[model samples]
Target chain A: EAGVAQSPRYKIIEKRQSVAFWCNPISGHATLYWYQQILGQGPKLLIQFQNNGVVDDSQLPKDRFSAERLKGVDSTLKIQPAKLEDSAVYLCASSLGSRGGSPQPQHFGDGTRLSIL
Target chain B: AQSVAQPEDQVNVAEGNPLTVKCTYSVSGNPYLFWYVQYPNRGLQFLLKYITGDNLVKGSYGFEAEFNKSQTSFHLKKPSALVSDSALYFCAVRDGATGGFKTIFGAGTRPFVKA
Candidate 1:
């Protein structure tokens, strides 16, 4: 099976500009997530989606960041008026499900490296 | 809330020698632990996880982790290290009670294996 796929492996934009990253989760996966990984830090969850509905997005900066998973297969994360701190790797991951029985290990894609000038 | 900690910023080992990376977790109830590896310019890859049953969980690339409930620790280990094993490793945990299923990750530990 194909693994999680992400586009625009690298991105560069000036501060205050807007940018967007895309993700395509593995087929049949019910859970999808977006994370940010700053240099020297672990990936931090930005948002999570179960099917087409958002499960959690508390960590997401509503003023500048937004994400959507239409039809439950693919997702897009956007950052408007980007700040210097937003310069980091944007990672997308997916898991089978998030139910009670058993937790599936999340599979990740090669993230898009975002640079703010 | 659930959290994880990787005590070591970096670990260095000679090829063919044993290696260990330390991790500790805090959670209210039973915890599900995971280990992931990230290569240069690559996304994090799942290494192993400890959900239940066994204390020793083996994962990809000859890596294994020992889960200790008493100590609240899950340390990654390998009998023999290879140069290619060098990478950034992260430990993560989630609380089973909440059913929230959000994973919290550690700062991460970089491993360097010398030939």
Candidate 2:
């Protein structure tokens, strides 16, 4: 089975520029997530989507960060007017679903590394 | 609110020696604990998780974590450290009662296994 796929493994942009990262999750996975990981910090949940509907996005910076999981398959996370603090890795993950009591481990993609000048 | 803490910023160990990375969590109800490892410039990889288990949960790369409810701790351990195992480790937790299922992660700990 193919792992989660992410485009533009590395990206560099100036501060205040807009950037977007795309992710294609593993086939048959129903849950998709986007996370931001700063240097020396763990990945933080930016948004979560259960199919096309969002399940949680409390941590997302609505003022600048936005994500969409259209068609319940692939996802895109966009950061407009990126700041210096936004220079970090963006990780995407997916799981089977939430219906079963079993806890499905999240499979992650290689992630896109963003560097803001 | 749920949170996780990794006490050590970095841990150094020699090959064939035991290695441990400490983690503690705070949650309102039963917690779902998890451990993830990240290599250089890579995404976080799931190692193991503890969700209503026998307290000792073994995971990939010969790693295991002990879930202690009383101490609110879930420490990752490997009996014999391997040089290839050097990487960043993160601890995470989720609240079970609310079904919110949003994970809270710790400030990662970097493990350096020397040859």
Candidate 3:
């Protein structure tokens, strides 16, 4: 089976610029997630989607970050007026279904490395 | 407020020797613990998880993790370390405190399996 796919594997932008990263989740997957990983740290959840609706985005910096999973298949994460702190790896993941009773593992993409100068 | 901790920033093991990476977590409900490995420049790959029942859960690439509820720990272990096992390992737990399924990861632990 094909894994989660992400494009623009690398991006560089000046401060206050805007950038967007795209992701294509695995087929039949109903849950998609976006995460940010900084150097020396583990990945942190930025947002999560269940189909075409958002399930969680409490941690996302709404002032600069936004994401949408249209048609419940592909997602795009956008960061406006990028800050130096936003320089990190943006990862996308997908799971079989909901985050319900049984636990499931998430399939991940290679991720997009963003650099803010 | 669910969170995980990887006590060792790095672990060094000789090939063919047993290797262990320590992990501890803090949660408000029944914990759902996971272990993932990431190679250089790659995204994270799931290794194993402990949601209930089994104390020792085996995963891919000869990896296993023991879930100790009493100790609030889920330490990753490999019986015979291989040079290829060298990579970054992460410990994660679901944010049960908020009654949501958001996952929180720890500062990764780098494993160096010397050949």
- Top lDDT hit: 1
Candidate 1 local Cα displacement, residue B112, angstroms: 1.1
Please identify model 3 stretches exceeding 4 Å from their true place: A98-100, B95-98
**lDDT by residue for model 3 (B10-95), tens:** 99999999999999999888888889999999999999988888899999999999999899999999999999999999998884
> What total of clashing residue pairs does each candidate reach?
0, 0, 0
Evaluate every candidate with DockQ and list the scores: 0.87, 0.76, 0.85
* Model 3 error, position A45 (Å): 0.8
Could you tell me how far off, in angstroms, the CA of residue A78 lies in candidate 2 after the best superposition?
A: 1.1
Q: Estimate each model's TM-score.
A: 0.98, 0.96, 0.96
- Which one is best on DockQ? 1
Candidate 2 collision pairs = none
lDDT against the true structure, per candidate, is: 0.94, 0.91, 0.92
| Tens digits of per-residue lDDT for model 2, A21-81 | 9999999999999999888888899998998999999999999998998799999999998
Clashing pairs in 3: none
Q: Write the per-residue lDDT of candidate 3 for residues A1-117, one digit (tens) a residue.
A: 999999999999999999999999999999999999999999989999999999889989999999998788999999998999999999999998545676688889999999999
When candidate 3 is compared with the true two-chain complex, its DockQ is: 0.85
